[model samples]
Target: MPRNLPLFIAFRLLFNARYYYPIFAVIQLDYGLTLPQFAILNTIWAVSIVLLEVPSGALADRIGRKRMVVIAAVLMVAEMALLAFVPLGSNSIVFWAWVLNRILSGAAEAAASGADEALAYDSIPKEERETVWPRVLSRLMHLTSITFVFVMLVGAAVYDPELVNRVLDWLGSDLVLAKETVLRFPIYLTLLHAVAAVAVTLSMREPPLETECGGEASLWSGILAAGRWIVHTPAVCGLILGALVHDSVLRLFTVTASEYYRLIGIPVAWFGVIGAVFAGLGLLVPRLAEGLVRTGTPRNNFRIVSLISLVGLAGVSLAIPLWGVVVAMSFRFAFGLLNYFTSHYLNAAVDSRHRATVLSFRGLALNLGFGILTLFYGGLLRVLRDGNPVEGGNDPAYRESLFWMPAIFVVLWIGWWYHQHRRVHEARP
Candidate 1:
């Protein structure tokens, strides 16, 4: 296997996904998205995944893995350009343009998903491929978190949060005055995506494989085969379902933690500190996963870690609002910690041939779950926000940005469902 392929994948994700999210959030703010509205946009991406995911997986295995990735990279660049160049103001035209970009992104994402895995699987010999895939994925995730944490820190540092407040204080200029800075946040983002596209184009490689991998089955067939595999292979399915539950919580909390803190009276400047803390703690996750591996019981360890995650999530949700976010954040580290081991579990599940496709399915599940949750969440926030329009509903604040009333509901709902699922699944005959 070529080492460059792994490096390329990491860089692609780092620049493509990691950087663009924060940028998207800022642009949506400029365009008239409320927190709930952003969730709606996220839901669109989620729904698109549901539509394209299985089909794309078949496309990768049938057509060519590397080709799809290249296409996705190109689409990513176009998407950023659309966001940057599109004129500001609201109306169906502007809103739908952004939505079109997201849908394109979703389709690109679907194509890219299976292709990269197929490419990576093809690059290595069968035995070595499975082991390498997880490590590659983990490194990519670590790079993404590391990159975003720093970007946010820098963005926070340069932009004065009080820009809005000062204008409000002097001009009594309610909001139109503060809009320019929020909109410009995308400029920095567009630049980042440009750099990311270059990195992907320059670095990505398609390695050859020994096995046949999967094939160009019909989209529906691919979907059905995937479903059958899990149904017949319950243990395999159990762990995957466990992972979905585990991952969604991880994404949701990480996405919104900073915003929740800000809302609870933590200052914007201090938000960087919270992010920094998350990045610093993230360093520990790999080591924790390593420790679990050393114990010689990855399966047992993952189950234990899932429970640990539940407790941590439950603790933060129930405690933070009551005690304040600073106190809640104190318990937040557990999610990051559990994530490392979860990665270990994912690595254990399959061999190279289906790595990307199966993993893409997992990605599909996680994203859809998030999108669905966000959709419901948006409704909840509207009820809670009493229908106030958002600065950017289509942005990051929707994901990790928080509303306490809705959050409490999410915490309870997720916790209850996780428990019920865990109970039923674990008792499987």
Candidate 2:
């Protein structure tokens, strides 16, 4: 019911709903960067987040969450500005400019990861949190879904010169936007959102921290304390572990969704529409997530997500013509459910002093898991390519990876479940 809660929701929407997300790769490539350079930039971005994620959370805990949020917003603006105005040629300067942009973007992501959630969650009255938090999350999910759908549609439309020129023609305007000009449109829109993020984050009221430490803790000390806490806290540890098991694989699938779509007979032109349809799932997914949270225990929820993930992975591996899209879409539900369950359980279990740090650990674990999976996938592709030189094994490698994902997930989930179960049993004395 506090002002910070709504502001937090608004800040998340603005910070995350980038218009260029639908055409992220295309925009980078259109800027004269090769695919290899693009991949390197992405790697830099990931490394930046991994390196800064936990430290930023500790800093947020040490300083103020609002300050970190504001920093993230500012960085968002700078990153987008780089893309919007950087030189077009494929020169070393342009590449370095993008590298700096990626670093700033990753830092922004790291700074915001746990700080924003901690700020908003702490703003709620303690007594009301049990009932109110779920509703807050559900509302956020719904709004984010709607925003992403709009961004996807409009972002993709504006990126295409033909689409923009046709609309201009219909309006009796002589302005014919070139691809170079239109390519920056999404970045410009995202810059506007970044500016809004700064405003919203600045307006947020910092909630009082309830420190468990004796006094102000150093960054290293805070990180160590949080790490130890997670090691000692079975519920929190289990929740994060379970989330990692599901989140990493689903995220990998999401990253490669376009490729999967192409292999399944979906045209490249319809990718934006498909993305919009995927985003639309947010409309109904939050409701289902909330219902499951209300009715199921953490164990039951984990099992449900696991089952959905397994089925979705197996079905997608079959690549059953166009209908496989349905199976692929199922991962969205797993993703939504896993995130909701993890957030709810982790927030309820962690203390305020280390809340953000613990959440950062969650982010860190998920990212590391994804990074490891990506490496394994890359290796799988390489092996497939080496084995068969005729077709380069691109499609087969992808399908083989997909086929293995379900089995891998199953093994990891069972291991995690058993480990948690054993820990619980041993602690019962």
Candidate 3:
């Protein structure tokens, strides 16, 4: 594993999240932003990624995945730098800076999405593909979970107002403890993380090209081929679309989770603990999901995972107690493997020559759905909270808006199921 450059790089890259992701909403709120405002910022991020996903992906396919990954790392540094400079309070300058930060972060994410996975996939030895790839991927997930849990806990500890205030007093510093100061601590940590990520990305070697298409293809040609492939392949389209819905809802839920925690009476200080617990649960999910796949099939596994996600969303909508939130969030364990499974399926179905472009299409679909959902969710908050979006997460109207999410998943599930069923029947002699 140590010698596997791609896998090792991925594992190290996961630790680049020194900032506490679970408390991101709280950080925005501390900056004097409202829920709808934060949602809009996230929508902007999603929109940016959606718009760039395919073009960047096709370019990676045309060029090389490793180079794009290095570019993404640089973007990450820029994003963090922007966020770190965002002013203490809500103002035009602060808001726009944060918005720019989101855009940069989104671009970084889009750039790396398909390229990183493709690089890792192509790096593995062909003989060890079936057995070793999943194990390596699983270990990567575990590494991410562990790295995130540790980072979140440490960041949260530093971001804790009471803890920082006490230390400030003990140090006899003239600086008084402030919300902005505490919140900025995590952002500062990200600067170091970004530098490390850039270093790691720079050291990564691109795996040998395995595509049989000979020389590099043009971006337009790759895009055209990818578009046609999606249209022509029913299973690929269904799988990507289904994943789009599932992932979008889950992503929104995640972005707003800290707000939900606050609404349910949990303090910002406890968010890190809760996030760590959720990450721990995530560590167990893929293994459990694989066991289910062994007993059943990937089709059944998808249904079960989707059902569990629906249940989790419903639970989030209704949860009032801290324990309820914890239990509700724990259900995301099922989601840990959904994308890996979907990506595997998509990678298998697409030609290697256009793999990154098609994967980018999947990213574009997911981001587009998420951007639209963010707008709708923000609209719901505006309506339900009487324009006081700060309290929207606690609003019954917000919970009610989420009730429809399960139905969306159901519809996508049925569509995917029908597509798979039809394909199977057509294959019958």
lDDT of 2 by residue, 202-318 (tens): 899888877633334477888998999898988888888888888877876776676677668775456677678878997888888888887889888888888889999889889
Top-scoring candidate (lDDT): 2
Instruction: Name the runs in model 3 displaced over 4 angstroms.
Output: 1-12, 15-18, 167-176, 210-217, 387-404, 411-429
Models, CA RMSD each: 6.1, 2.9, 3.0
The model with the greatest TM-score is 2
| lDDT of candidates 1 onward, in order | 0.58, 0.83, 0.75
Order the numbered candidates by lDDT, best leading.
Answer: 2, 3, 1
TM-score of each: 0.76, 0.90, 0.89
Q: Comparing 1 and 3 by TM-score, which wins?
A: 3
Clashing pairs in 3: none
Give the clash total for candidate 3: 0
Report, for all candidates in order, the number of backbone clashes: 13, 0, 0
The lDDT, on a scale of 0 to 1, for candidate 2 is 0.83
Tens digits of lDDT, candidate 1, 42-104: 789878877887667656655556666777777777766776677666656667877887797
TM for candidate 1 is 0.76
The positional error of residue 19 in candidate 2, measured at the CA in angstroms, is 1.5
For model 2, the stretches where C-alpha displacement exceeds 4 angstroms are 29-40, 91-97, 212-217, 385-401
